[model samples]
Target: GKKVIIIGAGIAGLAASIRLSIKGFQVDVFEANSYPGGKLTEIIMDGYRFDAGPSLFTLPEQIDELFALAGLKTEDFFRYKRLEVNCNYFWEDGARLSAYSDLDKFTKEVAYQFGEQPENIKKALDKSAYIYKYLAPLFMHRSLHKWSTWLNKKAMASYFRIGKFGLFHTMNQANQRQFKHPKLAQLFNRYATYNGSNPYQTPATLNIIPHLEFNKGAYFPTEGMHSITSSLYTLAKQLGVNFHFNKAVDKILVKDKVAIGIQAGGKSYDGNYILNNMDMVTAYKTLLNEEKQPTRLLKQPKSSSALIFYWGVKKVFPELDLHNILFSKDYAKEFKAIFKDKDIDDDPTVYINITSVQKANDAPEGAMNWFTMINVPNDQGQDWEYLKAKARKAIIRKINATLHTDIEPLIEVEQILDPIGIATKTSSANGALYGNSSNNRYAAFLRHPNYSSKIKNLYFCGGSVHPGGGIPLCLLSAKIVADMIPKP
Candidate 1:
């Protein structure tokens, strides 16, 4: 069997390692961190456990597909339940809404709370489904850079219908036109943030994001989000894939324009092929410095990052679901702060995810673990210390007003992860949560491809590459990379 070397052990890297090994390649994964999982890892302090990153779990079939390929039952190794209540909403004005997982129920709640027609919400989601149905098959499932993909009759059909996607309109424009009330438009507009994009500037084609939650559904792993990584990591090891931790890859060794191996841990380990799972920007700046850089893709704007406060609270709030959003009063103004001004607004939208709501062990008895976060511009050499201080104050103020509690006093244990920490830990350039902001209509097409054009036997996967970020898209990136590789 031919040997392959993979850099990074992020979700996409783990999935790709398993897929490659199953295809008869001797896979060796090198991760800089002492542990695997990258951002999709965990944290424990003062009897509370928190998923460090990427809380939302949609497209369970992506994880299921990996297990199915390995000849195992998915539930036997990993388990998750569909969230009945997707998320609870709160506004400073004392308005509230419960987003039930059931489409009919959610639509009814939207209508009842926001005074929009129930049918209108359904129609909007249907349009989202239409885009996802057509767009995913054509662009997401395969490599857009490949001519064969463009030549496919199915892709041709999708290309002809681009106008129907509202590609010319901004997401805000689409949402506002669809809803009579400002709140409903604001609620749907928040979907743009799923990929760290700004609805005011991002293309309406990104509206397909909602269908994933409202139609296909969102879920939670029974063992917490870290289980997604642990279960897959265990499966990869069991399948005979070798992983080297704390071995940072400093350079990608290439020979005559062909990727040959990696230089890591001050040693060179050769391979027949190279699978680079590192963030694209960081990889070019560090690992593949000598290789011809894809400057165009590199120039694409980095997506918004986050400022998270992992707090172990002394009490629980029954009104809160597994997910809760304390929306800012002015949604458009909030986005302007993040994207244009490169700062967080005084009233930034705050997201609170409590895994303890489902699994009791995540927090101490009669307590909750709050994964509180707010979106901010990715690290541009900003004064994060000042930003963090301002953000903490704003988050405390919002939570106090919306949830009706003095949360600062309830915090028994606390830790903070700003964009600088995110970049330092994950090697995601500029600490961008997603590789690039899908602000432009062509962002989906502009992402780096699965395989390198100039470097043979060199491939790229993970959130930084084609198909974009999040758990599902990262898995899809692995699939696309695997499909392109010939069996060993």
Candidate 2:
């Protein structure tokens, strides 16, 4: 059997290991951290457990597909429940919107709260669904760099219909055209942030994100988001895949433009195939160590990073759901601050995710685990300590004002994760969460492909590669890499 050396035990790396193992390849995963899951890992502090990264769970079938490929029942290994309330939105002007899982309920709620017509809401959602269905086969499910992908009849059909996908207009323009109310437009505009793009600059193609959460329904694993990592890691172990923790790859051993193995921990391991789950730019500079770099790919503008405050609250609110968003009053100014100025806005949008609402064991008897996050520019020599202090004050002011509750006294434990910490921990270039920003219309085609054109038997996966970031896309990246590999 051919041997595969997978770098980073992230979702993509683990998923690739499972697929390759099933394909009769002997797979071994090397992770730098002591634990698995990369950005999908967890944090435990002061009797509170939090999903340290990727709080939202959507398109769970991507995770389940791995189990199915291994000839196992998905339910036996992983379990999750569809959330009744997708998210609760809060506005400073005393407006509260409950995004319901049911389509009719959501449409009616939008109509009642935002004064938007139900017909318009349905039309917008239908448009989102149509865009996703129309482009999934061409842009998402297959590799754009491969000639095989372009030759397909489905790809040809999708290419011809690309004009209807709204490549010209910005996401904000699309949302504005669909709804008269600014609130409704703001609600849809938030979808651009899913891939760390500014709605004002990103293409309307991102409008398809709403369909995944609203129409397909958001979900939560019964054991919290960490279970996504634990379950997959467990499956890889059961498949005879060896995992080496705390082992960082120092170099991609190459000869004559062909990847041979990995050099890690002052030792070498030979493999027929090498898959790098590390960020693409970091892999080139740190591991590849060549004088010449992929200049164009490296120069791409980075996606926005995050400032997360994991708080162990001493109290819980009945009104708050598992996912909550306190939107900023001036959304455009907020994006401008992050993208153009490279600083966080004083009135930044705040997102709080409390897993204890669903899994009781995540916190103490009555307390809650709050994963409070706000988007910020990727690291660029900014003073994070000063920025964090300012952000905390701003966040408290917003939450207290919107919720009408003095939340300062409710905090018993706190841990902060800034872009600096994220970059140091995950090796993401410039601490960008989703790799590169999708702000440009061509950004979809600009992402680094899953397979390296310059090197033979070298493949890439994870957020930094093709299909883009988040758990679903990372899984898709692994599938793309596995498919591109020839049968052993």
Candidate 3:
């Protein structure tokens, strides 16, 4: 059997290992961190457990496909339940809106809270669903560069409907046109952050994100987000896949422009195929030193990063849901601060998630774990310590004002993760959550391809490469790489 060496034990790497092993390839995974899951990790503090990254769960069918490929039942290994309420939004004008999973309930909630016409909300959702219908088969299911894509009838139909997909206008502009209320526009425009793009700059193609969450439904894992990593890792190990933890890969060994193996921990491991799950910037600048990098593509602006504060609160609120958002007054200014100014906004939108709401064991008898986060620009040599302090103060003030509760006294433990920490921990350049910013309409085509055109037998997967970021897309990237590998 052919041997495959996968760099980084992230979701993409682990998923690739499962697919390749099923195809009769001997797979070995190397991880720099002691644990797997990359950003989809968990933390426990003072009797409260918090999911470190990726608080939202959507499109679980992608995960089910992986388990089915391994001949295992998804329910037996991992389990998740659909959320009744997707998220709770708190606007600066003291408006509270509940985003229900049910389409009718959500439309009614929009009407009740924002005074938006139900017909308008229905029309907007219809447009979002239309975009999804036009693009899903072409953009999400398969690689765009494949010859079969051009030949497929569905793909051609998607190409014909591309203009209607809102590729020209920004998501903010599209939302404003669909909804008369500014708050309603803000609600839909916020979907741009699903992939960490600025709504003011990101194309309206991102409006399709709502359908993935609302129509398809949002989910919460039974155990926690980390359960995804644990279940997949367990399955991979059962398949005879070797995992080498704390082994940092130094370089990709190449012979005549073909990948041979990887150099890690001052040792060389020979393999027939190499899969890189590391960020594209680091993979090129560090691993493939001799190879010519894509300079123009690499120079594109990166997606926004995040500043997360994990607080072990001594109390819980009945009004708060599992996922909550405290939106800033000026959404456009917030995006400008992240993209153009490259600074943390004083009035940044804050997202707070509590796992204890679903899984009781995640916290003590009456306590809660608050995973508070705010979007910021990717690292560009900013003074983070000062910014972190300022941002924390602002976030706390916003939460207290919106919730009408003094929350400062309830903290039993506190920890902070900034852009620098995210970069250092995951080796993502500038600590970008998603690889590159999709502000440009051509970003989908311009992203680094899954298979390296310059190097033979070398493939790339994860947020930094094709198909884009988040758990589902990262898993799709792995599938693309596995499909590209020839059968023995």
Q: Which regions of candidate 1 are displaced past 4 Å?
A: none
What order do you get sorting by lDDT, best first?
A: 1, 2, 3
lDDT: worst 10-residue window of model 2: 286-295
Which residues of candidate 2, in runs, are more than 4 Å off?
Answer: none
Better of 1 and 3 by lDDT: 1
How well is each residue in 294-411 modelled by candidate 2, as lDDT tens digits? Answer: 7898999999999999999988788889999999999999999999999989998999999999999899988999999999999999998999999999999999999999998999
Candidate scoring better on lDDT of 2 and 3: 2
Q: What is the per-residue lDDT of model 3 for residues 1-488, given as tens digits with 9 covering 90 to 100?
A: 89999999999999999999998999999999999989889888768888999988888888899899988899999999999999999976688999999889988888887788999988887888999898877786677777887788898888887789999999988998999888889989998898989898889999999888888899999999999998999999999999999999999999998999999999999999999999998889999877888897688788889999999988979887899999999989988888999988889899999999999999898888999999999999999999999999999888988889888898889999999999999999889999998898998887888888889999999998888989989998999888889865
What is the TM-score of candidate 2? 0.99
CA lDDT of each prediction against the hidden true structure: 0.93, 0.92, 0.90
Which residue pairs in candidate 2 collide?
A: none
Q: Write the per-residue lDDT of candidate 1 for residues 73-94, one digit (tens) a residue.
A: 9999999999999999999999
TM per candidate comes to 0.99, 0.99, 0.98
Q: What is the lDDT of residue 71 in candidate 1?
A: 98
